[model samples]
Target: MSLTKEQLLDYYRKMRNIREFEETIHRENTTGEIPGFLHLYCGEEANAVGVCAHLSDDDYIASNHRGHGHCVAKGSDPRLMVMELYGRAEGLCGGKGGSMHIADLDRGSLGANGIVGAGAPLATGAALTQKVKGRDNVSVCFFGDGASNEGYVFEAMNLAVILKLPVIFYCENNGVGEGTGVDYAVGADSIADRAAAFGMPAKKIDGTDFFSVYDAMEEVVAHCRAGNGPYFVEAETVRFYGHFEGDPQKYRLKEEIDNAKLHRDCLKKFRSRVIEEGLATTEEFDSIDSDLVAAYKGYVAEAKQAAWPRPEALTEDVYITY
Candidate 1:
């Protein structure tokens, strides 16, 4: 809320990038251009951008299956990301890791994991590294509400608090996990309440509101930077698409989904606030969106003709055993 106009625009650009990139991938996936399963982050832009805005290139982040947004928000190259989806050799992981495992260490992106709740431990390890080196860097773990149910999440929290490691357990609660509603999966009233048991400060905010998430994470990031150990944030968000591309989504109500899209859209909300506050015009945001869409299309075209991984390199990064 205290952000300058430039910073606000930057947030808008990042959110727009994530939304466009995921929607593009969703469209391309329908054509079978991408081979692996994709957990598109269509409606969860605010969570990723808001949190990552407070982080630096020196900070670390480990993400879940719905991770493209996290990578882009954490400063991963869009072109390289597209190439990775196409299984090109020039990809972030030489296309071997595909979408679920895209990573860029230089950017402090630990990588997206296929395993549920796995990122928490990885982030804790990174936080340990920060603690050992006495660096001010913090590690953030981005997982879904489903992953919060995983046992490792609690373990990671315990370790983080015990070691006083600087980390943040960010839970993007989209209200549905895989094909099941979160209310059916989680026993507690809210996911962030678990933080109380760990003695970590927790915040539950409107994931659809960029400012809400940004304000909460700004505090959390500052706390971690001061070596205040780990904190927990449950962003009550919504996913526009199903868990994966081609999912039937029979579990979700059509009207509910439509209502969220129409009334709870983060971009629409953000734009209205910015305009209402006299911070910027709709035309300025529109211009940024136009440029992003064009650039994304160009990236998609380039990725289509990108070089594929060599057959000889199939076993290159593999760990072989007898």
Candidate 2:
């Protein structure tokens, strides 16, 4: 499907938002203000924005630890996300879930999981619900290469195909899975190849290119919505930061990281493509960036002043009373 100029600009805006938000969090985390561990989604913006652009609030998505991008792409409010990171009561998840557990049911984001490979089953269950209810909506599970190696991911894939569930198993293979390289960890030729063994269609694409990811998602979404069962996508992407905040990153060389940032950055690639195709201008992109910067300033300011959850409220929302 060809994207309109407006759509192209919107994609750029979302990717830019993810980049800016992650970078801002990285800066803030250094000051010891934001509590908890943060897994920044710096270089994997295209995978989230491209895939989520094809989805709506009716569609469900389960995210992994690096999930701020998915939340932003799926239309979650960054203001509330900032507040959540700040542990403010007004934040999403009431300031309890923090970075790895931000969920907005209204937007169909099933929260980010701290446990690796946990979201696959959640999305599978959501897709099962959609099928049982006779709805056309689909569910997507965004997991990393590390999670792809987990046994439950394969179980989710086999179950989804057997039941013909409308769930897309999206894997972002960012080379390293928490300091361990994908080359040394995954025992298959590729994650997509491994997923295909479950009797579902699978494809691997250049996750760094927004257009490639978006186009492939278009086909994958159509297949699932048509009741053709599950699909798998392995996105070959990169992560700019360490596995987590404060990681020494002794596993890889500094030069390798520097080269990827300079040559394979998705934001730069998107800007160049759109401008070269005459679909967008430099000033237009610049305006969006400026607006995002100003808006983030407001979000950060409000979060700093936002209230914290009361001590007695810890028991609230922990259980349901019928």
Please state every model's RMSD to the true fold in angstroms.
1.6, 1.0
The number of the candidate with the highest TM-score is 2
- Best candidate, lDDT-wise? 2
Candidate 2, after superposition: displacement of residue 123 in Å?
0.3
**TM-score of model 2 relative to the true fold?**
0.98
Q: Give one digit per residue, the lDDT tens place, for model 1 in 1-322.
A: 5779998899999999999999899888888888988999988999999999989999999999999999999999988999999999998889899999999999999999999999999999999999999999999999999999999999999999899999999999999989978888999899999899898889999999999999888889999999888999999999999999999899889999999999888999999999999999989999999999999999899999999999998888666663
Please give the lDDT score for candidate 2.
0.94
lDDT of 2 by residue, 1-322 (tens): 3789999989999999999999889988888989999999999999999999889999999999999999999999999999999999999889989999999999999989999999999999999999999999999999999999888798999999999999999999999999999989998888888865788889999999999999999999999999999999999999999999999999999999999999889999999988898888999999999999988888888898889999877988878983
Instruction: Note the clash tally of each candidate.
Output: 0, 0
Model 1 Cα RMSD, 1 decimal: 1.6
TM-score of each: 0.97, 0.98
CA lDDT of each candidate? 0.93, 0.94
